[model samples]
Target: MRVEPAALEQAASKAGALENELRSVDVALHTTAAVRGLAGWETARRLEQVQSRLQDLVTGLANRLGGVSERLAATARNYRDSDEAVRRRFDDGR
Candidate 1:
């Protein structure tokens, strides 16, 4: 597969933005859960569970994006090295 650092970086940025949005929702959920729990609502626990699952999803996505970005960077560097090696061989008339 072709690798592009800029594209990967952009994706990482988008993931980061989503993470930020999730953070806001997470805070809201915490507040809501607290209020609901105090009122003895059974849904409060479910809301908390939802928040926790969202957190897990976001965390997993962030980790995957990070790994992808690192792999893209490594691929770019490998390609560069290969290109340089080929160029050197060509220039040496090998």
Candidate 2:
């Protein structure tokens, strides 16, 4: 069967319009994807920085707590020794 020229022209115009629309959609999709990828990378970097900061803070707190514990232990030992000396002095007097 032979196709009419008018119908062929109409079909060709429709195909061209569809092709242009597809190209526009593809460009938009690529742009959106690139933006999303960039955002993801930035977010990951920020998270890493936060994690590093938190680790530093935790380490500092741990060091401070260790020093405090050591000081307290020394203070307790000194008090105990002083009490024992006082008790010995009282026993000798009696």
Candidate 3:
């Protein structure tokens, strides 16, 4: 299989950007969840619950994106390292 280090790095960058965007949404959800009024009302309680669930979902997605970014970066590094090794071997044979 052919590995394109640049492509992998670009994908990693995109994943990182997506993770950052998700984190921004997570912050917004946190802020919305912090709103307080009629704490004893059933509707308010439900709204809070929904907000909490949404926040959890967003956080989970962000975490996954971060992992993907890390893995892609690692893969790119590995490919670059191997390429360098191959180049060195070729140079040494001269």
Best by TM-score: 3
Please say which candidate is ahead in TM-score: 1 or 3.
3
Displacement of residue 90 (Cα, Å) in model 1 is 0.9
TM agreement with the true structure for every prediction: 0.65, 0.53, 0.81
RMSD of each: 3.9, 36.8, 2.7
Root-mean-square deviation of Cα positions for candidate 1 versus the true structure, in angstroms: 3.9
Best by lDDT: 3
**1 against 3, candidate with superior lDDT:** 3
lDDT of each: 0.65, 0.55, 0.87
The stretch of ten residues in a row with the least summed lDDT in candidate 1 is 22-31
Error of 3 at 34 (Å): 12
Flag regions of model 3 displaced more than 4 Å: 26-40
Error of 1 at 47 (Å): 0.2
Q: Kindly list the per-residue Cα lDDT of model 2 for residues 1-94, writing each as its tens digit.
A: 5434445445545544544443344333334445456576876566556656665665565555555545555555566677789999999999
Model 3 per-residue lDDT tens digits across residues 1-94: 8889999999999999999998888544454544565466777777777878888898999999999999999999999999999999999999
lDDT of 1 by residue, 1-94 (tens): 6766557566656655665554455544445647565566666766666767777876676667566656665666676777789999999995
